[model samples]
Target: MSENNCIQYINCHCYMTIQSLQIKARMFSRISLISLIMIPVIWSQDWQVQYSSMMKCALKGSNTHLSGSYKHPNHLTMIKTFWIVNPVKGEETINLVDHPDYKGRVQYSQNKDGIFFLSLSNVTHKDEGMYCLRIVAKEDKYLFFPGIDLKVTELRVEIPEEAVEGKSSILFCKTTCHLSDKTNFTWFKNSKRLSESNVSDQLLLPSVSTDDTGNYSCAVTDHKHLSSPAVTLSVRYPPKSVSVSISPSEIVEGDSVTLICSSDSNPPALNFSWFKENQSSAVGCGQSFIISSFNSSHSGRYYCEAQNKYGSQRSASVSLTSAGDQKAVLYAAAAIGAMLICICIFIVVKKNIRKTGDAGGQSGVSKQEENNSTAVTDQTSAKPPKPADLNESVYASITHSRPREQQRDGDEDEVQYATVQHHRNTRNTTAEDGCQNGNSVSAGSNTEKADDSNVIYSSIKSS
Candidate 1:
């Protein structure tokens, strides 16, 4: 009776066990699927503060706004909310508004949308750091780690230490943080727009020159109002526009003269040399060249050379004349005038002389040259003038002798005299000097003569 019952029971029990195993496996699969879906929902609902931007680049000296939204378990009530920087004080939540560094510069605000905001004015380099939001609740306080990385920066112009003409140089527009690669830069020089290229953060100068010297600044294209301070850029160059200046416009012999050298360059040309035209050597070296006593030696075309570390330049020449040259011209004129005066005097004296015919009074005649003859004809038959008459007459006399080769020691010398010019007929009148060897006076005739007076006689020296 027990064997049939035992076998049936064992068969029913094995079937039941197999059915239970399949149902349990199905239930376990359902539970795992539910857990996988529910875990993310629970994690998403955990206490978390998320900012609008994970990283921000704010312009210095400008105001910036940062917003954050938070979610937590509904059972917890928020008691306070605040902002702070990294290296936070764990025990003391330092109030940003009360911080000496942030006082008067930080503001806290909230909106009906449950969005919390932090407004910072007059941002500065000191404000650059990681920022976090703290939510204080009745049961606990929460801080979101790996918070906002804020960068407060301004444009800055960085140039090569030495800027030289005719050389390449690069100027950088820099910021505290690296901006987006697509960000464009603007440049200004002397308060005017300098570069038109907007893709590069650097200004490239293929060749530097004095024209590039000026106050330079840079800015981001989007934040033009947040530009950097102007920096002076000096481009060095050699001396140029060299020129010479004279103190006195007029120059003369024995007068002092000064020559000045000047030029245009990045650095002033300190070394100056003066040279004369057609001369290779320098006459002097200095900004000024002085000739204490001007003379012919100093009269010439002069120029100056200005030199600096970069290069040298020569100035246009200026010419000068000595007064001695003027004096020489004056002397030549005086000599020519004297010679003309002597010639005029000799012509007058020769015209006044009368030529007597011979020593013997045989129809004695005075031979004389004439343009218009004023000669008195000799009257051989007329009586001679009285000695008293001769004494009152104006007359001049000169001694004439033959050439030394023909003259004997005892030979009589001929005497020529100039008589007063008058309208009259008169015999030969011979006036003899002490050297005349007994020349006879004219015993010849004389006609009634007009008063012989007021005749201007000129002297003729023997040639």
Candidate 2:
């Protein structure tokens, strides 16, 4: 037959087979019968089977069961069954009774309903294949079921022995089972999904770096089925992202400051060197540089270099200055000193002025008291003061002494009188002693009156 005619005949046959299977489907709800009828049409029409493959995922060294079915309606009993394996060598057929290749490791059985299955024990990489069942009816008719692709994937991640930064590296999602380019693959790094479902089995890192270094794994697109355990990927590179830090961001004079250096590298930064701006050589070494006492000498722009076996990197400059509080404190102290001095000067000046006023007031009071005493003395003595001392004016005068009055008798008609000086320094004046006949005669205490001018007329009696 011509190719076109053969194709047309195959199509016609497939249509008739589908119609027959559909008519019988109402009699039986079993899905195996319908699939068996359509398997031939599917195989002939499409070289690339569009139907999803029956996936049987098993771990290495585990037992698995692969199911296949071929059922027919009345007057059709299964006479013989065979299994076909598509392996690397080619397509192979194994009889259920005595298969030499899988002698004791495999068991095959068919139930009364015409469903067939096989159990593979201690499955290994070599046993992975596309399996199908071929059924022979008692009427000598034959049927083939669609394949149950047994994928005994020993899922694992393949990593390069050495990965360098800024270089390309590839990670492979390895499996012993045959996988096509259309198979969906999932990649994970550090348990995080790297990308959505992809068709490529290999994950490419255009430039492997520290960011790409992590635990990696792969899985089939179906989340229910996973491929491999995670493996680690390490990338080696020079020290990078160098940084410098101060323990206390604010620095102060007389305070100890700690300088820390850090960098990101695969082998880690093995050496650290500290440098100051405008300096020709490194000032310090190690991961940390300590200043026992910070000062202007320690204040400058500083940076650090981190080195490893690969290379070195320098950090950006960081500036350090004395804490502002120091200047503030100084200013405060100076101000306080000035204020204290001012206050002290004010108090001292006030005390001196008070002393001077007290002295002047006491001197004036002494002079006034002296004048008052002289005036009191002059007035009490009933004498005028000296012209140089004070001018005295008599408002009222007090008598120093008083004498008693007495009555004179006619027989003794002589009056006695005495003269006295008011002050011890004053001269006494004698009163004129005058006496007349028929008048009273004045008599002195010590001497008798003589005449009118020299002795007063005495009172003479008739006797």
Candidate 3:
């Protein structure tokens, strides 16, 4: 061949080879794309299944539905199965299907839309384990589907044994997992269904009494389980009827008194405290509290409280008063009695002096009395002045009486006259003979007689 023809032929041959290589690359790319579209993509066995953490089974029910979706292509047929593996038995697989080795039942179904559904029936705790689904196609190899961890939860509830009256009580009804779906929680009291509210953690009792106390329980069901643990509700609080009594109903100031606080309640009393109205500090405690000396400070409305673990109860108030008025009355009575005694003593002494003529006539007489008596009795013998006129004569005698020293000197002679005058006055006699002698002579005679008699009496008594 010519040199130019040879070069053109080589170039044409190289171009044909390049075109063949391009066609082959396109064919390989088409095949790879077809394979990618047709082959079932096996998800990792670590695929996660979305479900509630808590799975509960009824005692008599046959099936618990579990739902999930395969992550692979829709054309792939997924086969799901559940295995009850005993970890204690060296991971021994216990078939949960219609197999005789299984103690529970497990069934599965795939919808036309490729959604997978599973049912576990008569399941126990041993039936709970890791579940896996395998997917395969007519033209491709088998691939592992997602895995679901199954947990069997039991119902549980807790409540306090007792709650205080008029207080809020928490009734706990919780599931092993938070129920995200529709759930119903019901409370029962003594077998009667209680009205339940949503989103409330406490059973608020605005005011509770004895009638509100009873056995209580809670049941939580999420279209799955029912009947939780039962709890006893005991409402305890301070006594209802409280009263206080004072030892002396009538309290008096300066007198010691005791106040008693009493009430009826459960959970025996812890303390008894007394308080006065509007006072911040408590007075005392115990059934009886003593006031050393009741005073105005102690007076006022007083009340007491009986307290216990449950709560405190208050007693009715008792009024206290001071005894100042009553004491004053008693003091006045005492003063009157003393004054009467003094008056009586004065009267007795005065009468005795007049009867015995103890007062010396000279010193006992007044000057005005002596002047009047002298004027009236001048015409008379002045024979110690008749007693009927003694009133006047006594005045004269008083007027003529001597000084204390002179009277002492004349007392010996005047004593008899004074006695005669006293006797005449007692007899109410006006005759001058009543006295019989002149005043001085009579006085001397009576004075000697009186001295002799006194001496005789003294001698006899001593003997």
Off by over 4 Å in 2: 1-153, 162-165, 176-184, 190-197, 209-214, 221-224, 234-241, 247-255, 293-296, 321-463
Better of 2 and 3 by lDDT: 2
Error of 3 at 95 (Å): 3.5
Query: Against the hidden true structure, what lDDT does model 1 obtain?
Result: 0.73
Tens-digit lDDT track for model 2 on 1-463?
8999999999999999999999898657545545433633333212112213466666566667776654345566757776666623344455634666667887887678545668787777777677766556677634354466677666789999988998999999887666545667788877878767454778989987778889988876643145589999999999988998897887878899999999988889889999999999999999999999998877788999999888899999998788875577679999999999999999999999987996687567657656765787777688644443221122222222111123222443344333321211112222211211242222333333222333222322211
- lDDT tens per residue, model 3, 79-163: 5343333323234343446557453465667678656666767656665565544334454533222234565554455666666
- TM-score for candidate 2, please give it: 0.39
TM-score for each model: 0.53, 0.39, 0.39
Error of 3 at 192 (Å): 1.3
Worst 10 residues of 3 by lDDT: 454-463
**Which lDDT values do the candidates have, in the order given?**
0.73, 0.67, 0.57
Off by over 4 Å in 3: 1-63, 71-94, 98-104, 134-146, 158-162, 196-211, 221-225, 242-263, 272-305, 309-463
Q: Score residue 78 of candidate 1 by CA lDDT.
A: 84
Predicted model with the maximum TM-score:
1
Query: Cα RMSD for candidate 1?
Result: 21.0
| Cα error of candidate 2 at position 144, Å | 21
